[model samples]
Target chain A: MEAFVTLDAVAVPLPLPNIDTDQIIPARYLSRPREVNHADFLFHDARRVPATDEQNPEFPLNREAWREAKIIVAGKNFACGSSREAAVWALFDAGFRCAIAPSFGDIFRNNGTKNGLLPVVLPAEVVEDILAQLEASPGAHIHVDLPKQEVTAPDGSTHGFEIDPFAKHCMLNGLDDFGVTAAYEDDIAAFERRYGRENRI
Target chain B: MSEPSGPRTLFEKIWSRHRVTEREDGQTLLYVGRHLLHDGGATAFDVLRQRGLKPRAPDRIFATPDHYVSTAGRKLAEIEDPRHREMVEKLARNTAEHGIRMFGLGDPNQGIVHVMGPETGLSQPGLLIVCGDSHTSTHGAVGALAFGIGSTEVAHVLATQTLWQRKPKTMRITVDGTLGPQVTGKDVILAIIARIGAAGATGHVIEYAGSAIRGLSMEGRLTLCNMSIEAGGRAGMVAPDETTYAYLHGRPYAPQGAEWDQAVMHWRELPSDAGAVFDTEVSLDGSAIQPMVTWGNSPEDALPIDAAVPDPESAADAERRAQMRRMLDYMGLVPGTPLTDIAIDRVFIGSCTNSRIEDLRAAAAVADGRKVAEGVLAWVVPGSEPVKRQAEAEGLHEVFRRAGFEWREPGCSMCLGTNGDIARPGQRVASTSNRNFMGRQGPGARTHLLSPAMAAAAAVTGRFADVRRLVGG
Candidate 1:
């Protein structure tokens, strides 16, 4: 995992609400290992024409101006369907450092934190404003600062957001969650021994 | 663990029972009672091997190969694709290396993880369960606090047998009165999702209550809880009752002798206390819910069978109208067409949601003595080996075959189209799976979600027919 402090990059807007994980990375590609670069699988179906296997020019990611976007502005309940972590890996592997939505699927938000990608939740109106600004300026850059918990729009407007403190700490430092939980192994083993006697499973 | 002072909901009782410690940052470490795994979880094992970590509690873990296994037969050779075959073999090798119990192919207990968990009595009341797949909530029907986790969390549970968590708020959905005939638990859940949008239960664990919910059999409750993720719920659970006990009484892994009595006593106290409060309350009239079928890409796009495809012009706002138009275009549906008039190219009656014997019986009853319509293909894939055996003994397979429906082996076939059991592109399907997302069946495949009986009706009629009409509600 890479440490996150601040990033300034071009952002693209995907205005569809309830965009699910199946749309992010279809289930067919799920069997592949994490070592595989998942950027090719991200939106594999939606990025092509269904009838002819041709590149879909209408999709935002396919547009010339948004091809290098590092941030995604989406509608409510983004990534709302499955708990597949591959969805986050696809986005992160695609060079997206941040995702801004009015709300998000709980599991997706958790998955995002573990990876290097930052999931930023803002008010619906604020997200709409940022999306509109990005759409008006296709190559506009939106600035995200993790320590300040703020997002700066292209139009020079700033908005504040909230994240769990522990999550924030992990994001600020590129800490492996396994190491952190392993530190409490003693306490966990003690609890298990006592619980085993009481539950008698 | 110290008992908290105050009345508690079912979720609270389980959460406190599993709590090991809490940090000031609101992250609590909860002990996992059971860790279920499937073929898709092979990467998690690779992560563990890479880190040189052993499973903290191998005895508490169980696994089965479902996601990528072929439904044509119970052999590795049956899985033609090398990528899919490697995944199934890896699960067996990984479980063997770790000394964890895996119901691999050819085992009588082999099946989808969710169905195999409850059927084998590995899932019980007041337990904390986690799985890598999102449909792990299906175990919550037994009164356990089960939810899906990501790959990293899967690795976390395997290494430490503990996970960090923030407690979710509780929502109680009460469906009062008795459900009318032909209105199955699948319909009730679909109705619930339609009432509350797809993300209505996000960040909340839902507790299903009231007469109608309690009346459902254990299998029905599993079906209802299975789709909690479709509504964006962290988990869904029902209070254990006589039905839950009966279902687990003599299963392979269930408690026996004195332990059985003790377990029942504990489960008896697992329901919410009288007058216990919830963060949210939602009520529905059970008798009013009709058989449902989804017309759009999202599970929340469901509508009663009698309703027509909605017109974009009637949408409440501009954004909604645009979304509706896209859905209509993708589904190849015309506005104002009666849902019953929508034709389907294929019918799939399986998946974790509706593959139990009860679901098979429902579909078999409808398909009795009726031939499938011309040009429409239908398949009945059982959920597990046990379900397949039971269905065979009851002659349900013969009924389906006699009705011109293909009877197949057990696995997740055509649900997500990962096992080479996908519909052709542009094929419209009436499916009994939980999700109806775009391309969920296959690329450019349009899926309509419905109950098993409704799917059978569609198979016979060559269109989306109302189940109530055939079953005589």
Candidate 2:
């Protein structure tokens, strides 16, 4: 995991709400290993016109100005379905380091923390304003400072957002849960032995 | 988090018992009792292999290949896509290498992970269960603290038999009155989502209570809990009682003899104590719930069977109006049209939600003497091999076959359509699965979620109809 302390980059505006994991990366590409670059599969279905192989010109990512965006300013409840971490992988592989939304699916939000893609939750009106600003200036940059837990809008307004302290610490240090949890192996093993012996479960 | 000295809710009791340690950052390390795996876990296993880490406790894990397995046959070669076949094969290889128990293809226990966990008694009361699939919440029907995790968390649990987490707040959704005819758990859950939007339960663990909830069968409870994620709930559970005990009594993985007596005693104390408070409380009149059908992209877009498609012009705000317009366009539904009048091209009566023997019996009863309406393609895929065998023994398959619904092998067929069981683009489907998201079935496919009986009703009528009218009291 790459530590995410701060970033300033081009942001894309996706104003649609409830953009689920199935849209982020379809189940068809789920069989591929993590080593496979998932950039091509990001929004695999939604980036195209429904029932056609052609790329939909109206999609934000397809527009020339936002083609190299490293941030996403989206609507409420973005990535609201499924527990697929592959969705986060696709976004990260496509070079998106952060997402700002009114809300997010719990599993998708948690997956973002583990995979180094920061999911920032802001007030709905604030997010709406950000989306508007990004849409106004298509190739504009937004500043995200993790150490301060603040997001500077394209118009230069700074807003604070809350995140789980542990998740924030891990994100800042580039620490994955596996290694940190593995460090407590002895304690876990002792508990398992006692738990199994006493409960017989 | 400090240990409370007073009465605790069911969720708090389970959470405290599973707690191994707490970090200064407030993330508690929880000891996982059972970890369920499906074919989607192939990548998680790959991560473990890359790290050269072995499963700390392989005995705590159970694997089954469902997401990518072909529902048309039992053989691995039957999976049309080589990539999909490799996923299922890798599950077998990974489980074998780790010494984890896998109900591989052709095994009697093989089926959707959610369905298999409860049927085999692997999901038990007071246990903290986790699975890579969102529907794992279905096991919480047995009073377990079961929830879903992502691929990275899957690898973490595989390497260490625990997960670090901040505890979710507790909610009690009490449905008090007796349910009306054809008002099954599917209807109850849909009604809940309609009343409380899709994100209503975000960051909360829901405990279902009240007389109406207690009255439901185990299968109905499973159906309700299976869609917890659809409502944005971390997990949903019903307290264990005689119904739960009866269901687990003689199952393969359940405790036996003296241990069974001991386990039951402990389970009896697992329910929330009197005067124990929840962070949030929601109550509903179960009798008011009618059979529901989703008319748009989200599960919250559901309406009663007799309702009309919502007009976007009636929306409260501009944003709401635009969202409704887009959903209506995608679903190809006209405002003012009765839900019963909407025609469907396909009918699916299976998934982790509503694919147990009880669900098949309900569908079969609806299909008993009625022929499937022409131009409708209906399929009845059982949840697991045991469910299939049970349905066959009861002759439910013949009833479905006679009614023109295809009787297929067990897997998650047509649910997410990962196994080539998708409907054609632009086709409308009456389905019994949990989600009704955009392109959930297939690109450009519209899904109307309903109960198994309701799905059968649509299949026989060629359009959405009230199952209450078809299945007379």
Tens digits of per-residue lDDT for model 2 on B260-352? 999999999999999999988999999888899999888999999999999999998777898899899989989999999999999999999
TM-score of the A-chain for all models: 0.97, 0.96
Q: Note the residue pairs that clash in candidate 1.
A: none
Q: Total clashes, candidate 2?
A: 0
- The interface RMSD values of the models, given in order, are 1.0, 1.1
Q: TM-score of predicted model 2?
A: 0.99
**Which residue pairs in candidate 2 have backbone atoms (N, alpha carbon, C) closer than 3 angstroms, thus clashing?**
none
CAPRI docking class of candidate 1: medium
Q: B203-299 in candidate 1: lDDT tens per residue?
A: 8999999999999999889999999998889899999999999999989889999899999999999999987899999999999999999999999
